[model samples]
Target: MGRHREYDVDKVLDATLCVFWRKGYEGTSYADLTEAAGVERPALYSAFGNKEALFRRVLDRYQERFMNHIPEALGMPTAREAARHILFSSVELNTRSPEQAGCLGINGSVAGSDESEPVRQALIDFRAAGETQLRERFVRAKAEGDLPPHANPEALAAFLMAVMHGMAVQAKAGFSREMLEAVAEQALSAVPGGGAAPA
Candidate 1:
């Protein structure tokens, strides 16, 4: 039987999430987890199974708490507003901390090595889900006459996703908030209904 953990599991997991958020999966060693989680290696393994399994749990928590903006953006009144929300939110999250610049998911996806395929794929899948939600929202907008006749929701969704990923990379590369905001502005201009509604 596995030994019961004496530490606060949620608290430890939250700490572990910060380690992964800063260093990503491949970069986070078991020693790093033990030190960050305030637990011994055996205890971490006993509580969370293995490193991969523990990372999966951490990723889930991060998505739930830190990624709420994705859903909030999708639920906005207009598709243009939705895109604007997502773009700005991405910039905010990716650039808020020099200690953890760029997104946790994108950081993992970008930094993960071959041995970390599962971790990389998990981030990719999470990102794909966000794109799917945005695409569906844009599709609804097109049906409701919010978009021009020739606008393609699928392409627009892909474009926004690409721009977002680019923003993450740029943020990691030391671009400032003002620089990223300019990029967001350029992307917003391409949105079919980006302007204010008629009086």
Candidate 2:
């Protein structure tokens, strides 16, 4: 029979997630993970497999815990509101935790060695999925006349994502919340009817 885990799996994953968030996959090592998770190498391997596998599991947890705002934002009444929600929420999230500032997905694998290509691609695909969701939501907004007919849903979605990504990088660099908020506000100008609402 398999032995029962002496450690809490969720706690280990959370600690590991913070480590991954602060340092990219390639930047992190088994020693770092073990130190953060407070678990032995053998136990971590038994519970979550190799480094790549453990990162993937933590990535899933990040989505479940932190990315819920995206879906909620997408459901807003207007595309502008949806974009605004995502932007502001991102600002809050990116700077909320001082020890782990920035986004897990973006910080996870933006750049890495050839051996980490699969992990990098996984992060890319994960981000692309969010962009696709925004694009679809904007398309619906266009159809509903919430957005101008001339406004390109695809471009708008991409633009919003770019702004969010930039904000994440800025947050990692220690940009203040107010500064990020200003950035988010300025980005709204590009959205059709974005300036119509009072800030």
Candidate 3:
């Protein structure tokens, strides 16, 4: 029979996620992951395949662990409330950990060399998926009269995502929670029919 693995996979992945969140995809090397995971290079490869594969796993864990606010925001009764929850929650998350004070999805691969194009694209797709969910939610809100007839779900989703991404960058740059909350408030004020009651 095959021997059992010695290291805990969940713990390793959690440590690796911290490294990636702090250093990003291209910036993080196998050495960084190995050091963070407290494992040897060969063992990491055997368990999680190449660096890219391991980074992908870390992204999944990040979404599962940190991005739960998106779903909760979508379930809000009003579009404005949904947007409020997402923006405020994002501010809390981005600034919660000073050691890794940015979004993994954004910080992971915002910019990279040609060799890292795939990783960059992966992050892009990951973010796009979230935007799609927001857009769909806004569409439902419009149908339910929670938003104005002229409200554009696509534009709203794109705008909200842009603000969220900007806030993540700002957080990484040492912006305070109050500043990010002000930014969220400013963004919320721009939403059409944002004060409307739910239908």
Candidate 4:
């Protein structure tokens, strides 16, 4: 072998994700990433090129590790229950861990700019995909008699996504899990079925 790699790529990506999740894209410096990832600046640059490239790696990893659950959540029995699980799980993901708080994609929004078109588009696509999935779930729920016949599945999905993102932003602002749950409860309560909503 030419040289032995001193750092683990998986571990470094995990740590980098945590750092970005906590400090956000712009807030995290190269030094912060190096230190948090337990690698020197040169190593980080060698591995990832720059902060933007590194964040793309982190975001990609986060999508696979965390956000891929969206499809499964949508596949559940009822849209309302799926909505509840998605929101509550997001709250748990954001607040239950000390290593990172908030979502990487949501945090990415803070640093997103027109110049960062790829990153911004990725986040937008993530949100749109989520909204579409939620809409499908709502459509299925309505067909199954779990929701009112007149409910607009697409609009309801968009609404639930709004609630999810709002809660994620609030969680990033130091909201507690219980508080976020109450937020979820209130949002769910506003649905047509109240607490009896299925999913």
Order of candidate numbers by lDDT, starting with the best: 3, 2, 1, 4
Q: Give me the candidate number with maximum lDDT.
A: 3
- Alpha carbon lDDT of each predicted model: 0.86, 0.89, 0.92, 0.79
What does candidate 2's lDDT look like per residue over 141-178, in tens digits? 88877788898999999999999999999999999999
Regions of candidate 2 where Cα sits further than 4 Å from its true position: 194-199
* TM-score to true structure, per model: 0.92, 0.95, 0.96, 0.87
lDDT of 2 at 79: 83
Per-residue accuracy of model 3 over 98-153 as CA lDDT, tens digit each: 98997998889755688788788889899999999999999998999889899999
lDDT per residue as tens, model 4, 1-199: 4678899999999998888888877678888898888989988888888878888889889888987558677866666667777877777877867657777778877765666676677678867877877787787788878888878888888777788888788888888889989988888876654435454
* Model 3 deviation from native, Cα RMSD in Å: 1.3
Q: Using TM-score as the measure, what is the rank order of every candidate, best first?
A: 3, 2, 1, 4
Best by TM-score: 3
| Each candidate: RMSD | 2.0, 2.5, 1.3, 2.6
Look at candidate 2 and tell me the lDDT of residue 20: 92
